[model samples]
Target: MSGDVRLEARGAAEETFVDTVHDLLDVLFERGSVGDDDQMLFRLAVSEVATNIVEHAQSREPIEIDFALTCDAEQLCAVFTDNADPALIDLENVGMPDADAESGRGLAIALAALDELTRRTEDGNTWILRRRRQPAA
Candidate 1:
């Protein structure tokens, strides 16, 4: 579980977000490490991040997503990357805006769903998401 899958897209708009997530999920499913719930959560989290890039990342720059699934006797890890500017997002302040708000909940949900979430901007914003896969019975 120390392999990586690298995907790149130029001018990927919101219309292609679902396809990206599906592609990632298909890879994970093919590896036989992702279960039903894990698949759902992965799709949800990836979509949220991808949508954020499409909506707020300013330029329609090329997006690079690197999914690294690593497993030992403990857990699984997924890392995503995009070339969009990261300064626009305030990760520390992710919260529900209000009960009637239509947006602003995706990031919070993603935070809660993933066991570990980390974001950093070097050349571009990179998000690392980790979750513990269930042990074989």
Candidate 2:
């Protein structure tokens, strides 16, 4: 019950990006031995990340992102690699935005839901999200 699910979305709109992630998550949950709580939380984190990437990406050309999800007996992980310009994000400063804020809560929510979330921008932008699996009741 452990393998990988991958998808590539190019120039996708925010809605499309979320839909693509939903499709990938459907496949992952179906194939992996993930508990219901784990599946729900992971889905939320993944959707937030996908929406953030689609909404904030800056480039003259269409955006290109390679997304991968992997699961094993003990954990689940996701990686996102994108061709857009590197994003300057301060993860340490991420926090829930004000109540009136229309945006800015995605990273905070994602970070709170997952065991680990990291971003790298050396060659290109890469985001890694991981969570430890919970035992089924």
Candidate 3:
């Protein structure tokens, strides 16, 4: 709950809900002083995580979504949690989905955009994303 910026929402896991999640990231990047390039990459990585939850969570009731984005001297870190079913997604083994596949690419995109990306089953499902910050010009 405590971070440089924290965004929390409780709602149904539907595709239409992802834009609201993106708006949360926009707030974090703006207030937390993230630059344009870093903001773009962070947005993509976080969006993928949220999209995966919406499409796969299969929650009958509203699911809780939590996001924490922090910036330090070295890296930007994000932690996202959703009250969804425990899903075993192996980042190492999950290859790029086919070009024509509509789904199955979220994890891959997150993995590519993040310096460190990991998923675990905690109080539901949690995804941690970290990216090293480039030295200032």
Which prediction has the highest TM-score against the true structure?
A: 2
Write the residue-wise lDDT of candidate 3 on 7-124 in tens digits. Answer: 5555556776687777777777776677777778878888888788877775555777676667765677877788877777777897787899977877887888889998899768
Lowest summed lDDT across 10 adjacent residues in model 2 is found at 4-13
- Candidate 3 RMSD to the real structure: 3.3
lDDT of 3: 0.75
Of 1 and 2, the candidate ahead on TM-score is 2
How many Å off is the CA of 13 in candidate 2? 6.0
Model 1 clashes, total count: 0
| RMSD from true fold, candidate 1 | 3.6
Query: What residue runs in model 3 are displaced by over 4 Å at the alpha carbon?
Result: 1-11, 59-61
Backbone clashes in each candidate structure, one number apiece?
0, 0, 0
lDDT digits (tens) for residues 57-79 of candidate 1:
65455655444444343555666
**Per-candidate TM-score against the hidden true structure:** 0.73, 0.89, 0.81
TM-score of 1: 0.73
**Candidate 1 accuracy as lDDT:** 0.63
Residue-level lDDT tens digits of model 2 in 1-137: 54544444444545676787788788888888688999989999988998888888777767778788888888888888887788989998999999999989999999999999999986668899999999888
Arrange candidates by lDDT, descending.
Answer: 2, 3, 1
